[model samples]
Target: MASDLRTQDIQNPVDVAEYLFRRLHEVGVRSVHGLPGDYNLVALDYIPKAGLNWVGNCNELNAGYAADGYARVKGISAIVTTFGVGELSAVNAIAGAYSEYVPIVHIVGYPSTASQKNGMLLHHTLGNGDFNVFSKMSKEISCAVSLLNDQHEAATLIDNAIRECWLHSRPVYISLPSDMVQKKVDGDRLKTPLDLSFPKNDPEKEDYVVDVILKYLHAAQNPVVLVDACAIRHRALDETHEFIVKSGIPTFVAPMGKGAVNETLPNYGGVYAGDGSNKGVRERVEASDLVISIGAIKSDFNTAGFTYRISQLNTIDLHSYGTKVRYSEYPGVRMNGVLKKVTAKLGQLNVEKGPKPNNDIPDEEVKSPEPTITQAWFWPRLGQWLEKNDVVITETGTANFGIWETRFPADVTAISQVLWGSIGYATGSCQGAALAAKELGIKRTILFTGDGSFQLTAQEVSTMLRNKLNPIIFIICNKGYTIERYIHGWEDSYNDVQEWKYKELPYAFGAEKDSVLTYRVSTKKEVEELFLDREFASGDTQKLRFVELVMAWDDAPVALKSTAAAAAKTNAEN
Candidate 1:
């Protein structure tokens, strides 16, 4: 570990930028996402020299989105942008990362300290001579904020900022003044890696909570484990999976928890979304005498607008912040440690092989005689085409709701923004996710988005084409916002959008003619034919595939229709 310290002494220090990028590389950020701006250009140059790839995006917002996607896969990601114009442009994406608990280091380039002290108005500034405004705005979304002023304190500030980002699994803001980019700082700090270990739990509380959980878990006639998105965020998926395997209990995943656990396991039940859950998922989960929910985030969309019927008294909710056993709550109880302890103790307990819930995925039923495309017909067929280790990114509207019907193979990763509900996020995130997969040796990157959402940030596809990253994209051409129609207005003109030739988008976006494959399927037969093609299902990395699946505007997934109705009713009642 001493060799990890710089070969040179503190007297021969490296610039602040070099030190920061090296630290990021040590923490597992292989690539940095951002667009070049004057203030940050010098610091951006240090990225490649630090052994990190500089992924230049088309815009700052997309760069932020890309960073979030990369962080979800790589554990931590960094993004660099220029002053007010560039940093402020990424606010929405940063806020989404904050809400969903993604760790992203947002490094912004600021004017020199002398200019700030002299009250000089800069181009990116608001002309009010106030350079602190943007940093103040960022304080609301980031878990930590640091503006490096003195060279002596720069190393400590940078270390603390990154430490906070990893500890909380949230975004952190760092403003690097132009003058400080090349300032000498201690390189000896690099020898010692940042401390990433979780805090130790209170021994007394840990024993008491574990006993309480074991009491209910052992006494219950039928027990189930429910996995959610927080399990992924908190790095407890592996522990959660181990607990399920050792306990031999039935398990179900929430909507946001898709792909966290392998669904191919014998005791794995389908998704549990209250009324929207697969055939027997809701019934089996609610019927259980004890429910051990891990990393649960019960949002409106995730729960189908509060349609769940499970009793609070019968549930033990384990969260990142704490643990709850029926009525009593214990704060600061880490699930990371708790899950480990539970898994280790599972072998000693008398756990049962509970009754298996309905794990069958039924065949698609045909209702339309004319072979027209429909949600009931499309989602099931798509499920058959999915392979192991394929990463799927779903857009907010129809794609998010419809993907709930999907069944993933083992090791597949599913990424979505159910809680933030951001439109046009998938297109930007696909570019990053594909790159991340390639870095991690993952093969296929598949994306599903409605036409309305695609129109918002379609240009990111150009970035993908430029990078030669192959991601299979499906654009659901429904002519308008179908989810919005179900939520507020069924026939209002406000939900309509301008129609474009969806299949020709790749060509228009600069993809080589033979390098990419494009398809337009209007009927169920056409979709089936394309899906069954030998080359199309091969998960090829050399070429990209784009498909436009046209469907009826009014038709939607059964889950979406019911959830929309509930949301609409709530709106009317309020």
Candidate 2:
């Protein structure tokens, strides 16, 4: 057999570090993100040999964030960190990735197995000498944890960890002992790449579920399709798209599923987050008799503080795990197969066209007194300026809510943390996303973050410059945490942020004056002129551009105000 021959071959021995890095490279990890520490210093040498670039981040936390962004854009990513302190610093970002179902392989460089067994007092470890403390902490968030002790089992464990990370679409932790870095392992394992294929659904059960959905779908006169984050995260967009388009039903997306649907489609309605949805979308969805909800995550924030008005009695929910029709459930039926079958068997439907989703950007209104930009005017105008296929990331604050009004062009990829609303996540994430975009030859990468949030992970801008990445970044210059002010802290000093000359950060981050462009725009005229500039938006020169977009401290988007008020009330409950 080929396997037996490979095991007996003369060139069977290879360093464990080389094998691990090769596996990562095979799984589409073009770059590894993390800082170098003494424990991981030697292993870093094998990265180049495996055809992987080392993306040295400013800190471990930023590294984790960047890895997450890269995974969302590039399908899978990896990060390496030193033992205790480094791993702990990156845990928050890892947890966010876990909550949102992004796949990342977190590789930790640990002290040697001998040192751990002998109870040696390592510098990164506590005096108690328990070696498993940090990894045990990660156990809560990780889908699988592989601690490589014996050289013989290392390859199997590493393969299992990476396979689980991809299949589950969640973070997995792997431990590499310092002494085992160069230990010889079977070199022939790389002869075949990882078997990363997803498990197929049971054919009989899938067909039955598909039939159940189609029955209701045909019976109802005013049926609608609702798509959500899992459709994108679980890689069911192709099937979901086919079902939506072929069925020709009125389609809508949840707030977290902003970019899943082509907004330019005639049947595509705007966001449907109960109270936070545009008025027309809300009324139409609530009135529908049958709602085909695909890959839905009805979290408090995603559903506008649990304000979803649709009844489960009239809903048929399809998920990666199973499909549900009213009171009945199909346990093993996955969405991928069911969607494909339903789309294929969809013979006819009475497609009732509703009012076309209102997408027209507003003209200059009422000759505003001073041209001060408000959230209402800014979001709509943003719709007019956006181009196709742009990677647009928004902070988990006002920008997250304001982006709802922006009508994306076809193929625009919108990134935001709705369920896992981490404040400083966007800046670091932008760094990783921009790098991934560059590798994939994506034209433009853009980011919108609050001034307060930008201060937290502003160092990632330096990483962007170091890679020669050209993402257009917009810092929403709100003086303080505007969303928090609406929630409970109207006049609290803790909500305020120190003012910084945001546009001047590129020079501080080592970008030459001519290599980058910077702007500080306040009035409507300034924003208009900046948007109209072809060179800025066209990505012709591939230069990083930073803009300080000044807005009032008290201004917040309509959705944010409603969601924040609900959050405040929920906090006060017993």
Candidate 3:
């Protein structure tokens, strides 16, 4: 039944913007986080009309961090802002996303063609140009950079940028000029659809590498596989689980990679960080003849300040970017190959059957038994309280340490910008994470953040209240910048911050005091009491529970020494 009808036409620019926004919506991006400015005015106007919410961020860095956190839960996220200042401020978060393999789309608005010819000093304009701005800052962090000059290029470039983000598991930048965003083009040209593909292990390379990996696996008396954050970002969870089960190898997750494989599995050892590492896990990792690190980044913090004295030769590094195979007496081979090659080879190894050590260690030896009342003490307890259905969001500072120290059960989800290391991220991120949790029907959304970080995006509490989200937020009240004090060797004034009545935040934000529980804990006993009481329960009324744990500003966690050492090493390298 072929029929011809008269078609109603809209301007090209409006149609292009609508098409791009629709695609983003199709991809599960609920909102775009950024600050509005002159260059991006048109797009900002088009956002609501296109049915996408605009999350107005206080600053660009926080906006980017929020987007990263959102992506961690939603599979993808986006941020939009103006030229130079906005873009530059967001570099830290974008770079962090790149390092951690978070898929995000960054849309920057540039000056129009007429303005460039004027040669006057424009807001957010560098002496150079918008192209140079994106070129220099976006090269390493973004998988692709597209300039929206021709209206015809809008759909294609936007689609390409989005595709690159999903393919590479990294951020991509798209620069939209003011003029192009308002100009019209043939709407018929915007019909190119997007294609989504899952990353596969290279079959050819797998055959060869698997052979090499199996040789070592068969010869080793004790072999273990270590999974890290990269495994989670690369969608290798099922593959990792299958490998663990088939190989029957003991598995341990790095601090960042916790919960990638089921923590409750018979062969699973808990996280390997500070107090979380059981004596059994430590011994197993040290005693292994071959240690296969799958998508692991052995950061000094995660590895006890690089104190795990593994012979460089006994290590096999399998990462998303590349692989490194080392031997005691020979130079190692670093190659760009698919993980399937090695996994398939290792699959053939004989399954070792026995009751292995549980890798649990006594509290005193594993960590200082004395309570420091710092964020570290809070994490393990929080981890224990968290259920598989819970989603934990951590802010920068002690909250990050909390995440580093905590162990999540198989279904528990966690999100943080560890690489970006931006302050105030967790506060706003909790909002986005909470929204995602609600959409996904996840119960018990929790946030652990520092007082300093909370101040950066405290306004989001209103958003949480308005949305009727039940998020239990624990604010570590050690004054301010606890992490910076350690990094800067206790630069007292710079690191110290003024105190606020932490428990009153929810009430100030118009939440019911009874429903929104608040606690002030100064000792370990207090912490135990509150957690055991379950004062911050979710029910008919959405709750905003705030737990203020008191500690000394200069009373750094033991892990700070490793951070300081790393800083020293970085300074020396520079």
Candidate 4:
């Protein structure tokens, strides 16, 4: 028997665009971000009618970034763009979503079915007349692709694409031809919510695996849990935290997993990215008898260029799809189910709370009490000032590296292009994140980005201002590509960037004087004063706040300096 969640025998016909937008709404996408072009303008017409907000981005690329940011907060997001030109422009952002396990639905408005069949030379199409090229390129980045023309298949195709996106935690593509906008299709699928849940393991196999894991758990004198990025992507944080609490195990997070677990947890160890980790964390994690890693993505940067010393022999790795108990692999096991079972079984064992881990920044390392603003001083101070549920989006360079040292408060979510490492992503994404946060009743959206990276997508700030969002943006003015300078050449002129008077950008971007707040901080006292200011600290929604923090060109976070040295050596060898 089919599930009752489906509409049994009733079939309602609705416009293809209506059905698509309604389905997206049913799945929690309240807004669709994109730029309108000739090909997609008609589809954009249905957006407001279907009760979805049309977030008019300045460009296709910024739309993609906004969609990614929204997806990170809202679990799923959609972006609409025109065919060749618009889609191609958003490809880099889509690629970042893929690399970082963000689920986004990329909807492209293509030429009409008749135009494609006749190979009509459309305004947006290449003169060569192949309309299939963009979809082919999108296939490389999207988990699922659906090119729709027939209304009969549109419902299933759209559902399938969304399912794949949800199941894989990655981006999917949907190409809607202009002719199919009003075609009547079955709206039956809209009654049934998407079943993105993973299949359960065989009961016997699951029990056997759990028992074996419990045996390992029982014998270990020192067991530790390492949380990684997938813990958030897989929606396994609750189970992960339960396991950690029940077992009383020491827990550490990877660089990519910064905000997944609450840093305020008693057993919480700091980030464990090899040498980049807090002092003594590496020793405790490496010396543990068993290290259970949940959804770990050991990207070079996350692991400090593969400097992790934990042996696979003593590691039990749990992922979205499977679980590996040291040498044995359970292919069908899901981390959600596996973690639940482990937490239950953990109650049967007498687990002792380990020594209290020291995850704090030492007083001696805080700052030189110097007048100059340094990363060590700035990051920790920012950490202290951060409130609960503040969403932090960091750019790919110095800001990204600097964020690793900052401890996130409870329910604080962090968004970044860590694996993709795309420069200038945060500025555009901050706009989307701020909007999403507003929609979800999250008050504060904070962005940290470097001067060079910020220049890449600075225009998105105009979009934020237009939307009346209040995101506190901190622009680190190092005056160059600081991360690149460390990676290849420390003194090379190629890494330098042109200076911008960032404090005046809000006014230059057409923001009304009272609607925005601007500040420049060159000294530690200034930064501290800004933190203490009610308007700055509380982030008054009436005004968008922008801060330019001036630092020496060569200054960088300690983690960035160390990882860059290793990265530089690796690049030289390659």
Local distance difference test scores for all models: 0.86, 0.89, 0.70, 0.86
Candidate 1 lDDT for residue 349: 43
Model 1: residues with Cα > 4 Å off, grouped in runs: 1-9, 347-364
Measured with C-alpha atoms, the lDDT of residue 479 in candidate 4 is: 82
Show pairs that collide, candidate 3.
12-185, 206-341, 280-359, 313-327
Q: Write the per-residue lDDT of candidate 1 for residues 99-160, one digit (tens) a residue.
A: 99999999999899999999897799999999999999999999999998766789999999
lDDT of 2 by residue, 418-535 (tens): 9988889999999899988888889888999999999999999999989888999999998978888999889899899999988888999889988898888898888989999888
Worst 10 residues of 1 by lDDT: 352-361
TM-score of 2: 0.97
TM-score, structure 4 vs. true: 0.96
- Per-residue lDDT over 1-574 for candidate 3, one digit per residue giving the tens place of the 0 to 100 score: 1111111243433455666677788788878888888888887887876678887766787777778877888888889988887888888878888988889899888888667656657766766534465556788789898877766567778788888888678999888778767655445544555677654445665555556677778888888778888888876666777778768788887767765777667787655543335435666677778877777766655664456656658887776555666742111222223344455555456444323423232365347756556544555666676677677887656666546555566677777665556688787778777777777778777888888888878877776776677788888888788777766647677676678887887788788756676788887778777777744554223566777878766665455556555655765674
Tens digit of per-residue lDDT, candidate 4, span 1-574? 3433333443686788998898888788998999998888889999988899988998988899989999998999999999999999999999999999999999999999999999888787778889999999999999999999776678889889988888898999999999989887767667778887777777887888788888998888888889999999978989998888777788888989989888878788778899888667888888888988999999888988778999998999999878899989999888888889978877554343443433244476553566888777677777888999999999987788887777777889999888888888999899889999999999999999999998889989999988999999999998889999988878888888889998788888899889988999999889879989998878445689999989989888888888888888887784
Supply the TM-score for candidate 1.
Answer: 0.95
- Best lDDT among the predictions, by candidate number: 2
Is 1 or 3 the stronger prediction by lDDT?
1
Enumerate residue pairs that collide in model 4.
Answer: none
lDDT of 4: 0.86
By lDDT, the better pick of 2 and 4 is 2
